[model samples]
Target: MWSGPRNLSTAMMYAFAARGDCAVWDEPFYAAYLKATGIDHPMRQEIMTAHDADPDRVAAACRGPAPDGQAIFYQKHMTLHMIDGFDRGFMRDCTNVFLIRHPARVVASYAQKREGPTLADIGFVQQAELFDQVADWLGRAPAVIDSHDIRTNPRDALESLCHTLQLPFTERMLSWPAGPKPFDGIWASHWYNAVHASTGFGAPEGPLPELAADYRRLVDQAMPYYERILRESGRNPNSPA
Candidate 1:
């Protein structure tokens, strides 16, 4: 699955990891992103040190045999990580699911932790770019699940996504143990505290943060792409694939 920061991506990762047949990978391309861009992210040194920094090597591993011979390898990816020169051919072997949230929410949530995040930082443009490329490659749009739908009606939304990927929806996906797992990225401590504290989806959030000037500009910059993907995505949570 591809998503931006502060989306329900970690939650979705835990959801899939709950399934016995699935082996989950969290933000496999993150180290590569940091290495390529040389951006100063929280835990940047630790992340780059802990994970492979070569995108080609990471891509090779992603397309390699599923770990421990698991039936499904659920790769949780950030669209922004596919920086220039990153190979996308590995995606053809996998079912790509795009998970999106409103750009306003993403901007607000991200700003709380990191300051001055541009549109690129939140990944709305990169996501739409990849979505279009994948759609053209597949001759149709891939499955997409909005964070709102998942938060409000997870079972229906996940069932539809599973149908798209030709997998079964398990009750186990609805919940999991409240803590980190072996599969989590080393940066999880900085990024995953909320998810680590949850057994399942948390209660619906109340009013979102009031965007600062920079964040509001980012939202404006990203809205077009977000709206485009939202229209192309599978909007009905209960629809068959």
Candidate 2:
């Protein structure tokens, strides 16, 4: 899925993994881009700290045949990763999904997870630019989900997602059975507390801690584009980022 920073894009990746037939890869492009650009971001560092190391290379490791030859493959991607001078190799040869959350919650989650940029830290125009790049790939008319809705109703959200992808909605999609799965994103543990804390989708989450004012301001600035995407996503008003 194409997304911007601080969205629960990774958790959504986990949710897809929970469905049990999807071979998930979290930010595969990240390690590749890091190798290519020698650049770093805070979350990127958290992502690469795993014992195996080198997610970019690891992404390459999964490049061959599909696991089980029947499972869906879900990759978590970021908007900024598509920037000029960044690797674009990941964009080819794939059906696309675009996931979004209110930038406010994204900013709040950013604050909670790392010491770096707030969603507000980057400003709306810049965020919009990133979204535009993401939108280009996802299509002006692609599947989009609001983080709030995802927090409120995962089953319906995922059911609709299944329809959009033209895949069946299995009970497995709604929940994870006990087993080991690798969800090796840079920020998984740091950002996944809320997701792990849930038994089922609950109410639409309110703004995250300490981000109310910024969330409101961001909402005002971002509402127009977001709402427009909502009308075109052909998705439940609520979907996970």
Maximum-lDDT candidate? 1
- CA error at residue 150 for candidate 2, angstroms: 2.5
Which lDDT tens digits does candidate 1 get at residues 127-235? 9999999999989888888888788788988898898788989999999999888999999888888899999987656565677786788788998888888777645
Taking all chains together, the TM-score of candidate 1 against the true structure is 0.94
Worst 10 residues of 2 by lDDT: 118-127
- TM-scores of the candidates are 0.94, 0.70
lDDT of 2 by residue, 15-78 (tens): 7777767777666656555554566555665544542345444445445355666367777766
lDDT of 1 at 138: 85
Candidate 2 lDDT (Cα, 0 to 1): 0.59
Q: What is the Å distance of residue 63 in model 1 from its true position?
A: 1.1
Worst 10 residues of 1 by lDDT: 232-241
